[model samples]
Target: MTTSKITAEDVAAGVAELVPDAAPVEVVRPLRQGRSHASWVLESSRGWLVGKVLLGPAGTAGLERLAEHRRLWQHGIAVPPVLAFTESCASVADRPLTVFEYVPGVDAEEALPALEPAVVLEVMRATGTALAALHQVPVEGFDDAASGLGTISATWNTVVTSRVEALRDAYRFVDDIPAALVKTGLDLLDSLAEEVSPVARPAVAHLDVYLPNILLDDEGRFRVLLDLEHVRWVDPAMDFVKPAMWMFPDQQSWAEAFADGYRAAGPWPACWSERMAVATGLELLTGVKYWTQVADHAMREDYLRRLRAWVRSDGADHVWSAISSAT
Candidate 1:
C-alpha cells in the first residue's frame, strides 16, 4: 500500500485519532529541513512530542525502522519512547505516522560547538558500543525476510549503480560539477563491486547513523538516537563507516576511540577493524552518489567539503588504495 501525502492538519488528525483524548495545542517544525520525511514538534496538554510522517507510502522499510526502534529501546539503548503509531488505508492520509515522546535534547550537528576532542572521543566510543549492542539483536522466524549474505554483497552494486544514474540525471541540468570527478567516483564504485563481502554473519544495525541522527540532552549526555529508517540485519561492519565519517572526518584518530569503545563494550570479532578500510570506502562511494544526485544545493556543498577533507585525510588514501588493490 502507498502512503499518502501528509499535511500539518493530517498529522494533527492522526495524533488525535491515535490518542483520541489528547488535544494538540500547537505544531512546529523542529528540524531545519530533511529530504527523507517531514519531522515536526507537536505540543499537547500531556507534554511535548515529535512526529515523523514518512514521505512516501508506508512500506516494509518504514515498518522495519519502527520495529528496530522498539527493539533497541527494549534493549536499553537511548531513544525516544514511541507513544503512538497510526496506520490505516482508509484514513485521510494513507501513510502510517508515528508520534514519539519528545526527548528534550539537541542534535549533534547543533551541539558540535560543545563537542571537544575528549567529548568527541567519548561520544565516538559510546556510539561504537551502542552499534555493537545493536548488532547483537536476534531475529526470529522472520530471518528469511531480511536480506541474505548474497543480497548484502549485491546491495553495493545495486544501490551504487541506481544512485549513479540518478546523479547523472540530476547533473544533466547543472553544469558546474566536474566530469572527471563523476567518472572517477563511478569507477571507484565499479571497482568496489569485486571486493569480498564480509562473512555472512548477520546482526541488526541502524544503517543510517549520521551526526544529525544522534542527539544530546541539556546535561551533555547522549539523550536519544533517532531515525532508524535504514535498519536491517546485515554485516556488523555496515554500521561502522558513518560514525567514523562523522567523528574522524577523514582523520583516522577517531578510529582508535571507536576501537577502544567497541572493545570496551564487548568482544567484537578480531577482524572488525581489519575490514574498516573496505567498509569505509563503500560508505564513501555511497556518499559520493548521494552528494552528486539526491542532495540539495546547500547539502551538496556541505558534503563536497567533507569529501575533499576525506580525500586529503592522512590514511584515507591508504584506505582507498587497499580497496583498489583488493579489486
Candidate 2:
C-alpha cells in the first residue's frame, strides 16, 4: 500500500485545530530513529509530546496503534497518550496522521550499559514484571487477524525447504556454511509446525520488546515501555524475551536475576525454557529477513553480518534444543 507523506506542519495545524486549548510549541522530526513509521517530537504548552504519522495515507495499521496506546495507558502501562488521531486526510499533504503526547526519558538501550550490573538487572526484572501486567490486560477487538505472524510463518515455511538452497546457489557464502549445519537448521524449520505449538497463547503481547522500546526514569526505574505499533494478542513468550535482547550481553547472573524478578510478579509458564528458545530463534530469523528485505547497501551489509553471527552463535541452537527437549 502507498503511504501518505504527512508533514510536521500539517500535523501541528491539525492538532491546533482539534485541541484549541493546546498551545502549539514545536514539531521535531524523528527521522531514521524508528522503523515502520515516522514520528515527531511535539512541544505544546501542555508539555513535550511525540506525534507520529504513518508513512503513507495507508493508515490501516495506524488506527490499531492508536487504539493500543489508549489500551495500554488505561491498563496503567506508562506510554505516550494519544492527543488526537484522524483519517480525514486534512493535512495539506492530505495524508493520514496520528499525534501523541510525548513522554520524556532516554531509551533503555542507551542507558543500560552505563549502569552497574545490579541496577541493570533490577531494571530488567521490572521490565519483565511490567510485561506480565500488560499480558494480564484483557484485549478485545484484536484477533489473529490483527497479526503479521501468520503470514510471516507461512512465508517462512515455504521458503525453508527451498530458500536455503537458492541462496547457497546464488551466494559464495553458501559454501561457507557446513552442509551438516544447514541440514540441522532446516530440520528445526521443518519441525517448526509441531515444536512451536505448545507455547502459543491468545494474550496481548508488546510484540517488539527490545531495549529501545523501554524507557527509564532518572532513578533507573523502568519508567515506561513505549512503541505499541507492533502490539498484538499472541504468545506471551514474545514479550518475555526482550531483556535478553540487550541484557544477554551482561551475564548469566542477570538472566537469573530477571527470572527471579519476573516470577515475583507472576508465574512462569511450564516449559518456559523451550518456549524462549523457539521465540529467540524466530526472533533471529526475523531480524535476518528484515535486513534482506530492506534492499539497501547498508542493510545488506548488516544482514550479512547478522547472518554470519547466527551461523556461528550457539544461541539459536540452544533455543532449538530447548524446544526439542521439551517435546
Top candidate (lDDT): 1
Query: 56-101, model 1: which lDDT tens digit per residue?
Result: 6556556656766787788777667887665442333566677787
> How many residue pairs clash per model?
1, 6
Which parts of model 1 are misplaced by more than 4 Å?
1-9, 86-93, 140-200, 250-253, 284-291, 295-327
> Residues 197-280, candidate 2, lDDT per residue (tens digit)?
544444567777778888898767788877777776555665655455545543666566656665777667655655555455
The 0-to-1 C-alpha lDDT of every candidate, in the order given, reads 0.59, 0.58
Best by TM-score: 2
Q: Compute each candidate's TM-score over C-alphas.
A: 0.69, 0.71
Candidate 2: where are CA atoms >4 Å away? 1-8, 18-20, 23-25, 28-32, 56-58, 87-96, 140-187, 195-199, 296-327
